[model samples]
Each structure stands twice: as structure tokens, then as C-alpha cells.
Target: MEDNKVDSKKKRLNIVSAIIYIPMFLGMIQFFFDENYRNDGLGWLLLLTFWVIRNIDQAIRDWWDKKQKSVLFDLLLAAVVLVFLIIRGMEYFSS
Candidate 1:
């Protein structure tokens, strides 16, 4: 019974991650191609929606892993975001 519970939890997390991460990842890519972000609102809406879904999915996974309070994961996630932002900033400056 305990083993089944763990397996089920893992399966659910995988399914949820797929449902959230796939679209969120694509939305992030779309932001780069979107010029509407300059004047229109749809791009911003998409960004906000996808970001929320992505973070929610991460939170769910973290909870399932019993690491909801872990600082290491938060720090690593922050580092990745910081690096991505730095890289994007450099690209913008170069262009």
C-alpha cells in the first residue's frame, strides 16, 4: 500500500508537470517572437498565465517530494531564473 501510494504520487506529478511545463515552455519561447508585447496586452497575459501555471506546477511537485520548505530548491530555481534573465538582458543589449 505504501509503495502504491508513492508510485501513484510520482505518476501524478509527471502528468501534471507535462500538462503545465509543455505550454509554459512554449509560451516563454513565444515571448521572444512576440512584438505585441511592445503595445498590446495579449502577450503579457500569456506570459503571466504561463508563469503562474509553471510555478504552481513546481510547487505541487515540491510538495509531493516533501521539499516544500527546502531552501536549496528555491535557491536553485532563483539562480536559473537569474541566469536566464542575465542572458536575455545581454542579448537585448547586443541587439
Candidate 2:
């Protein structure tokens, strides 16, 4: 019974993650093929959602491991993505 419950919990978590990640995966695939993909509002929305989710997940893992260097790297990467998103947003609207 305990093993069954654990399996159920894992199954639920997998389903939730799939719901969250599928759209981001689609957007990334599109962006890889099309240079102009960033201009699309749907792509931006999915990317931002992905960035936020990914950073939060990394932050939690880093905290659990008490890894300062990894945390700093994650922060740096998040900042770069944030900057890219902001710059592209401005250009997207300006034009």
C-alpha cells in the first residue's frame, strides 16, 4: 500500500510537470527553426513562463544542496534571459 501511494504521487507530479512544460517545449522548437520566432507573443509568453519555472526549480535545488556557486550561476543565467526578454520586448513593441 505504501509503495502504491508513492507511485501515485509520482504519477501526479509527472502529469503536472508535463502540463507546465509542453508549451515551452513547443515554443523552443519553433524558435530553433525560425529566426523571427521571438516576435510572436505566444512564444514570449511561453519562454517567460519557462524561465521563471526553471529558475525557481534551480533555486530550490541549490538551497537544498547548500551550493553557493551553482546558485550564483543560476542567478547569472536568469539575469541574462531576463535582459534578453526585456530588450526583445522593447524592440518588438518599438517597431
Candidate 3:
């Protein structure tokens, strides 16, 4: 039914939002408690994964929506990509 299709689309959008928001929120918490956690690598890894998720979501949106080429979307995608790249560079240098 048409309703089913609409529900499916909403579900997909919710999933994409969660993928970007959840880990980032958790990572922000873990970052603030670095001393207690005592593992900077783990925190960084979580944050990096968060960035990757956002980037992937942005890519999906770009492909699915014709108007996804907005400046805000571009900035978000670029920022996420840059964060992940920095994380990769840090991991490479650290190990």
C-alpha cells in the first residue's frame, strides 16, 4: 500500500538520523570522561566511527534526494570526512 511505502521511508530516515546522532552523543560523553576511561584510543575510535556514519548517511541522502546538494549538506559531509581522515592519520601514527 502507499501507506506502507511512506512508513518504510520514515523508518529509513529515522535509522539514518540515529546512525549519526547516537554514537556521536555517546562519544561526546566518553570524551569528557577520558581520565576515568583511561583509553584515548577507544574514545577516538568511537568518534571516528560516528563521523563515518554521518558521512555515509550524507552520501545516502545525496544519492536519494535531488536537492541534497545544499551548502549545509556539503559542509556536514566535508566535516565528517575530515574528522574520519584525521582519526585515520592519528591511528596510523600512533601504532
Predicted candidate 3 versus true structure: per-residue lDDT over 1-95, tens digit per residue = 98788668868887879876976778767775867654565666666666766666666665555555663575577676777768776875687
Pick the TM-score winner. Answer: 2
Instruction: Decide which is better by lDDT, 2 or 3.
Output: 2
What is the alpha-carbon lDDT for the whole of candidate 3?
0.68
* Candidate 3 residue-pair clash tally: 0
Model 2 misplaced stretches (Cα beyond 4 Å): 1-17, 30-49
Question: Taking the tens digit of each residue's C-alpha lDDT, what string does model 2 give over 55-85?
Answer: 7567655765689888878878887887777
Model 2 C-alpha lDDT versus the unseen true structure: 0.72
TM of each candidate vs. truth: 0.47, 0.55, 0.52
In candidate 3, position 17 carries an lDDT of: 94
**Once model 2 is optimally superposed onto the true structure by TM-score, how far is the C-alpha of residue 6 displaced, in angstroms?**
14
Give per-residue lDDT, candidate 2, residue 41.
62
Residue pairs in candidate 3 whose N, alpha carbon or C atoms collide under 3 angstroms:
none
lDDT of 1 at 16: 78
- Superposed by TM-score, candidate 3 places the C-alpha of residue 19 at a distance from the truth, in angstroms, of 6.0
